[model samples]
Target: MAFKVAIFDWDGTLVDSVEHIAESLHQAATELGFPALERNAYRNIIGLGMVEALDMLYPGLSREQMTSIREGYARYFFAKATMPQNVFAGMADVLADLRTGGRGCAVATGKSRRGLEKALLTSELGQHFDLTRCADETRSKPDPAMLAEIVAFYGIEPHEAVMIGDTVYDMDMAQRLGMPAIGVEWGVHDREALGQFSPRAVVGSVKDLRFALGI
Candidate 1:
């Protein structure tokens, strides 16, 4: 195998939390007197951070309103939602295969630290990942800080690592850090959007991910 380390994105990439996210976004929007987004619109915002997603939803919202909406969203999310989300069909099997192959794996997500813990614990996917970097622990994506942190923590050179994600933020960060990225098609963004970051390749399914690793 050409890669020793693999890093994944949490939200739309590994887990299908779009329904929970939309429900929470709706609750927050209603509280803020803003219109709730349709499922598709909210899905488009899936890979972005909370602030960025809210900004897109209500562009004219004041900073204070944004803060309130975000807080409300988190409250609703934690109270009304339970995750492990919906594991992308073959994700668990693929992860297990990777682990068994002696590849080191981790996660970098915009999800809060606690949210990540809850999701991992619920999914029982924690055993597959060696480390997890969440928004609370590092700067949000598109910043490269999280990716850099993961690379450093794993003690691997950037080239020895591959980021697998479904968004431009993930791909762009990999690009910035001189690492390879494989974008997922069945995620928040489509191939065109992911292509903007020039990932090494675009994977249409979990089975393809094994090929991405030359398994």
Candidate 2:
């Protein structure tokens, strides 16, 4: 049977924001006089929110420093976050195809509302998705809150939706809700990491995603 709804992860899955994200965190770390994070370090935390990423990067810093760093990152990230980002190849087409096929699409992301809106609008892919569950409105990734909220909002059972993302957090959330999940390899996480979550299928590109969904 076709899925009734599709819930997606934002950063790495749909929009290629890893470089922009890493740069923001690096700038924030520098502003706080903390060690700058390597791309790999930031990559590992791709599914987490900005504040949470800062907290992980500067674990030894005091709460005050964390808060300050988070503020600095928000300022830096918002200023240039959409610059390096673009819709992953074929993702927009896939979303459009899904929409045409009468499946509803939503985003359940760790991004703040402003950040999510900027990325989606700037990338010109916002029109395809029907709902957005941002970090400000729900608990962070790896938590089922965002996914659960989307399911509830659509009045659909967990099985009626499939969460598509590139991170284990997405898969974990799907598992928690007993929903099917498809992992994309082109995103931050590799097959090995995604394999640990045992998603229903691991796709290498956005084009493959359609097949994974059995479309």
Candidate 3:
């Protein structure tokens, strides 16, 4: 059966903002005098919430440190706003095709609600998705609640939906919810990392993703 709902992970899957996100975190850490992690280290946490990612990156933070870093990151993240134009080529078209095929489109992301809203506004891609779930609003990725919410919103079975993302958390989230997953390697994780969860397909490019989805 064809997928009825297409759930996407925002940073890597829809837009090429992985670097921007990582840099934002780096900028935050610098301002707060926190030591920076390697670039890939920051990228690896792309699909987790800010707090979770921060805790992982800077363990044993006081509430004040977490709040400071979060706000600092948000500032740089917005100030460095070229992301709307960074929407991956063919992604908008893919979304249009999916909607035309009577499929519901949604987002299951690790970004905050405000951050996602800002991205959606800047990118003007908000119209493409029928629904969106952010980490701040619910459980983060690898926990499955975000994907489950998208499926529940569309009233579709797990098999009737496909989660597309660039991270292991996305694949693991889908796996936990019994939903099929498609891994896009252009984001954070590579084929091998995303593959272990048994994604339906691990694609390297937007065109390949179209083919993978039978679009």
Best by lDDT: 3
Residue-by-residue lDDT tens digits, candidate 2, 1-104: 36899999988888888777788778877876787666789778878876676667666777788788778878887886453337777888888888989999
Each candidate structure's TM-score, on Cα atoms with residue i matched to residue i, is: 0.90, 0.93, 0.97
Report the lDDT tens digits of candidate 3 across residue range 6-39: 8999998899999989999999988889997899
lDDT score, residue 34, model 1?
81
Candidate 3: the clashing residue pairs are: none
Worst 10 residues of 3 by lDDT: 76-85
Model 3 earns a TM-score of 0.97
For model 2, what is the error of residue 7's alpha carbon versus the real structure, in angstroms, after optimal superposition? 0.7
What is the per-residue lDDT of model 1 for residues 88-195, given as tens digits with 9 covering 90 to 100?
777888888889889999998888888888888878788999888987677877788888888899898999999999888888888999999999988777899888
Count of steric clashes across candidates, in order: 0, 0, 0
